[model samples]
Target: MSQLYVAVLAIIVAVLLAVALYRATRVKTKADYLVAGRSLPAAVLVLTLLTSWIGAGSLFAGAENAYKNGFAALWQPAGGWLGLLLIYFIAPRARKFAQFTLPDLLEARYNQTARVLGTLAILFAYVGITSYQFKGGGDVLHLIFPDTVSSQLGTYIIALFVIVTTALAGMSSVAYMDVAIGSLVTCICIISAPSLLHQAGGWSALHSSLPPQYFEIFGNYRLSPHGVLQSPAMGLVRALEFLVPTMLLMLGNQVMYQKFFSAKSERDARNSVIGWIIGTVVLETLIVAIAVFGRALYPTGEVAQHPREIIPYTARHGLPAILGAVLLGAVFAKVISTASNYLFSPATNLVNDVFVRYLAPNASNKRVLIVSRLAVVLLGCWALYQAIYAESILQKMLWAYTIYSAALTPVVLAAFYSKRVTAWGAVAAIASGTVVTLAWDLPGVKSLFPHIISDRDAIFPALFVAIAALIIVSLFTPAPSEAQLAQVAE
Candidate 1:
């Protein structure tokens, strides 16, 4: 059975590599490498967007949340669903402002300082995200070949393959490969969810076997022995911690914006979001359901101990042979798809925002392409290093999400909607947000105000400081000039 799963995964990797190689041959210019020549249609855009957004974050971290918290886990993804509502209004405008990377938009609307600060924040957030995808892929590989492959070895294998594949054709390969992978994973999850429920003896069995709190919204606190139900405010705070970061990340996700830049037209970009919202809602709900069912089926043992592995463990032991193999393959491929998208985004930032913009404004297309590939290899190694030391998938996911949410989202949204936001204010927002988030959990800093910082998640403080800086500083300073405002004007 393990060998069958390995064979399916091996086949998927081969097909992905072949597609990547074919796409590599089509790369000719900087635009071709970074934005797929700005020619992707709505159909392709939808799948790529869906695949990029639903990653190890969904498969591992999200599954872990479901295993532990039940339906209340939906609060995390509910944030993304809400962000998608706002994105429907922003997508067409983003396409109209097409550029290579988010930093490009930042510089146009803010200043060079804001652009550089934004780039740094993106690197911190995105590299952390890519690292966990490596970790998740490694977990799946170890599961499939446990006798011979340790999780550490699996991490190295996944890192090497993802780096090489991402360096091959850039956005063209990533986007097209997603079309294949996203379809497989979406179909498999749709099938696996109902199948797993039936095998678990249906929803009636699930409710009876699991804690009754598992079925309630915000039931996360209710399961605790201390019974925090006495403090509903704390429950709301806990739920908001999950909700805000996911929503903010979606609103300002550079990966999503880059895909919009790749779209052939504004219509394509807007249309893609409609499909993306539907796919995301359906897929995320299924992921949580599958995880909850898997928990009920396997009440104890290894999976119960390491809840992050529930999805893959269910694939190996819970499902039938053929479906299990395919579902396992989908999990593996989705991780790679996400890692490539994230790894490629930061590389795009370094090459387009720093190297090409400042270091070699006159560099030839050939030279830029070479540097682009090199950046992917270097950043991928950085992500692999972080993966090596990472402890929990859900912890890493929230940390990365909060960094991007607090640091970049405020300034990015201001650029699109407010002419009163001056460049210095944007810089202040980015700097304060990044610093507070990174420092909020440190032992020394938490000790300074243990009551406020120790127990609370960083998103609340980080986002507050960021927004306050943006609004207060902008009000004190002169309004942005017409020139600055014009850059982002719709």
Candidate 2:
């Protein structure tokens, strides 16, 4: 990577973040810090959601998939398409019944117990999710200048920057920054996608490079590295990634739904999902192409040469310097924007769901504000440490997704879709999902799922077991009161 180009990009990101840091005020109320007082316009909503979802998962893991599977890596973005399809149907309902979080939704539907458990599930995922962004951001810094920045320090720097941003103004600042960075990335990707495609000798030339299997949606993927399908049944795992978590996202996830609550109007919420569908398909298509054709440029073993840096490798070497700088900044922005959004989330939940609800229900808003800020610092430091030391970006991202999806998805579905669920059902689902995800990470199970299937695809089994446990428990027990059903129906 060109030092000048990388420096220019870093300088640009630093300035944007610096501006946000200055925008934060002393918290007048928790609302001021957490949701920007529920006043985001359509454009800001679109941008914040886009950037928040597109980070390490889209750029790094997407590239890694492209490198390993050729065009077969399109599955990652395809999943997004399905997710957006889900949001289209799900978002309006979520907006209509707006609340601060996934737990907020559960509390509305079930009770205080559901809210607390849901908070625990989300924070569990938030920690893991935020940690991976730190992991990816550190990788970007190292890629740009491996000689100067140690990976650990790089991770710490990224984490610290995110912590500072989140600590300030919280989601209010996050929403504004997302609007700016989101537009930059979308426009840059649109301008550069054709350029990369043209440089890769066009579609026909690109087609000449890969084996025929790369074109198939699920081709080259098997239960093992030996390249043999376990069975058509095993393919269920891939589909479930799109199908299952999507159900969870629509039914379970609160952070994105919180955006809906914050939208200036219901029409704004609808348009935000529309923008998301269009932008996501285009942006992800180009990102996957960069990795696919990048392989046509520098196929295997280049990742280890600069594993995290390989993305800039493709951009810097593949595109002209100006375009290279723009896309690289977009990539880095993905790293920072997403991390900043999530880093603040767990802290908000820690304060609202756990601390205020149980620890000090009568505490002053001033005390809540102080604890929220402090929680952001404590959680930020822990996630940064995990990002730097615990595992690779891929590992951290999957661990977080599985833990949260498993723990929360079922309880969420039962809350929104089925009133037959009891509090025990929610607790059972959360516990089962958390335990299964944790156990899946033990040495024996890791050897099976992630290598054969990326964490993107592997978490379905745990997610299912968690939901199934919830249902089975609900089947044997009494149902929640009609009051709970009426709340979710709203």
Candidate 3:
């Protein structure tokens, strides 16, 4: 059975690489490499968006949330859903403002300093996000072949594959490869959810087997880092912790914006968001359901110890051999797809935002392409290092999400909507948000303000400071000139 699973995963990965190699042939220029030459149609955009959005964060971190808190895990993805509503309006506008990277938009709307700061913040958040995808892939591989492949060895293998695939073709490869992977994962999850529920003896059995709070809106309790159970009120706070960061990340996600920039037309970008919203909501809900049902079937043992592995564990132990193999393969491929997207994104930032923008503005397309792939390899190594030392996927996901959410989201949204926002104001916001989020997790910092800042997640304090800086600073500074405002005007 383990061999069967390995065979299935190898086939899936082979197909993915073959597609990537084929796409690599078409990536001759920077635009082709970074934004698919801005020629992706709506369908490709939709699937890539879906694939990019649902990765290790949803499959591993989110599944862990569902395994522990049940349906309340929906709060995490609910943020993305809400953000999608606004993104529908922003998509066409983003397409109009099409550029290779998010930092390009930041510079246009704010200043050079803002662009540099934004790039740094993106690297901090994206590298952490990418690290977990490596970790998640390692988890899947270890589950399939535990004796032969330790999780640590598996992490290195997954990182190599992700780096190679991403370096092969860039966005054209990532976007087209996602079409196949997104379809496979969506179909598998849809099928797996009902099948797993039936195996758990349906909703009635699930209710009887699990605590009632599992079905509640806010959930009844949450487990602290030390494994202590907290009150229902704390559960609601936990839900908000998940909800706010996820929403903010969605609103300001560079990967999503880059996809929009890749669309063939403004219409394609906007239309893709509708499909993206539908696919995201459906797939995320199914994932939570699958996790919950898996918990009902396997209430204890190894999975109980490492709840993050619920989906893959259920794939290996609970399902029929063929179905289990396919499901496991889907999870593995999803992690690779996600890692490719995220790993490619920050690499794009470094090359386009820093290398080309400053170091070699006159570099040839071929030279830029070479540098781009090098950036991918370097960042992939950095992400793998982070993956090696990472403890909890859920905690890391929140930490990364908070960094981007509190630091970039407010400023990104302001760039689109507010003409009153000044350049220094944006710069101040970015600096404060980044500093507060990074500092919030420090033992000494948390120890200094135990009650006020210690109990709260980083998002609250970071976001408050960021927003206040943006608003107050802008109010004191001179408003942007007509020319500056016109750059981001609808």
Candidate 4:
């Protein structure tokens, strides 16, 4: 059975690589390499966005949440659904202001200092995101081939695959391949859930066998010895910790904006959000359902210790041979698609935002392409280093999401809507948010404010400080110049 799953995954990857190489032939200029030459249609944009958003983060971290807390895991994705409603309004605007990277928007709306600081924050957050995709891909690989591939080697192998694929054709490969992977995974997940539920002897068995709280919205709290709920406050707080980061990431993700910029038109970009919202809500709910059902069948053992493996474990061991193979292959391909998108985004940032902008303004097309591929290699290595020390993909996912949410989201959204925000204020906001999020998670800093920072994640305090800086500083300083405001007014 494991061999069958391996064979299926190998074939899927080969097909994807073939497609990537074919696309590579078309990537001649920097625009073709970075944004698919700004030619993606609505359907392509929809699937690519779905694929990038629902990667290892949803498959592993979110599945782990459902395995442990049941249906309550919906809270994590609910945040994104809410954000998508807002994105529907922002997508066309973002496309109209089309540029290669988010830092470009920062520089146009604010100043070069804001651009540089935003690039740093994006690297801090995105490298962390790309790191866990490696870890998650490694987990899926190690789960199936445990006898031969250790998790550590699995991480290195997956990282190399992603780096090569991303460096091959850039967005041309990542965006189009996502259409295939996203559609396949959506169907597999929707079909697998009910089948898994029926195999587990139905929902009645799940209800009877699992804890009652598993069905509840806030399923993460504990009970007292006397059987009373003891930590409702903490449980709600925990849910918010999951909720905030996801909402913020979706709203301000550079990957998403870059995808929008790739659209054929502003209409294509706007239409894609509608498809993305529906696909995201349905697929994410199915993922939580599949994991919840998996928990019922394999209630203990290895899955209990490492709940993130629940989806793959159930697919390999609990489902029928053919279904399991396809499902596992879908998961493997989804991880690759996401890793390529994320790894490519930061590479573009370094090249377009920094290298071309400052270091080599007169560089040729061939030179820019060379630098772009090298940037992918260097950033990918950094993420691989993080993957080596990372114990929990869920923890890393939330940490990265919080950093981007607090540091970048506020400023990104303000750029679109608020003309009064000055360049200095944008710089202050970005710096404060980035610093607070990074510091709040440090061992020494958490030890100092255990009450406020111990149980909670960094989004709350960091976002507060960021918003305060944007508002208070902008009011005291002169408003943004008319030219600066016009830059983002599209």
Question: Measured by TM-score, how close is model 1 to the native structure?
Answer: 0.98
- What lDDT would candidate 2 get against the real structure? 0.73
Q: Which pairs clash (backbone N, Cα, C closer than 3 Å) in model 1?
A: none
TM-scores across all candidates?
A: 0.98, 0.91, 0.98, 0.98
lDDT of all predictions = 0.94, 0.73, 0.93, 0.91
Clashes (N, CA, C under 3 Å) per candidate: 0, 0, 0, 0
Pick out the ten consecutive residues of candidate 1 with the lowest summed lDDT: 221-230
| Residue pairs with clashing backbones, model 3 | none
Q: Global CA lDDT of candidate 3, please?
A: 0.93
RMSD of 3: 1.4
Please write out the lDDT profile of model 2 over residues 107-201, one tens digit for every residue.
77766776877787777788878888888878777666768987777888888888877777787878888887888888987887678778878
Q: Candidate 2 at residue 437, lDDT?
A: 72
Between prediction 2 and prediction 4, the one with superior lDDT is 4
Model 3, residue 185: C-alpha shift (Å) = 0.4
Q: Which residue runs of candidate 1 sit more than 4 Å off their true CA positions?
A: 222-230
User: Candidate 3: where are CA atoms >4 Å away?
Assistant: 221-233, 452-455
Query: Where is model 4 poorest over a 10-residue stretch in terms of lDDT?
Result: 220-229
Candidate 3: residue 88 lDDT (0-100): 96
Better of 2 and 4 by TM-score: 4
Q: What is the Cα root-mean-square deviation between model 2 and the actual structure?
A: 3.0
Error of 4 at 294 (Å): 0.8
Span of 10 residues, lowest total lDDT, candidate 3: 218-227
lDDT of 4 by residue, 5-117 (tens): 87898888888889899999999999999999999999999999999999999999999989878888999999999999999999999999999999999999999999999
TM-score of 2: 0.91
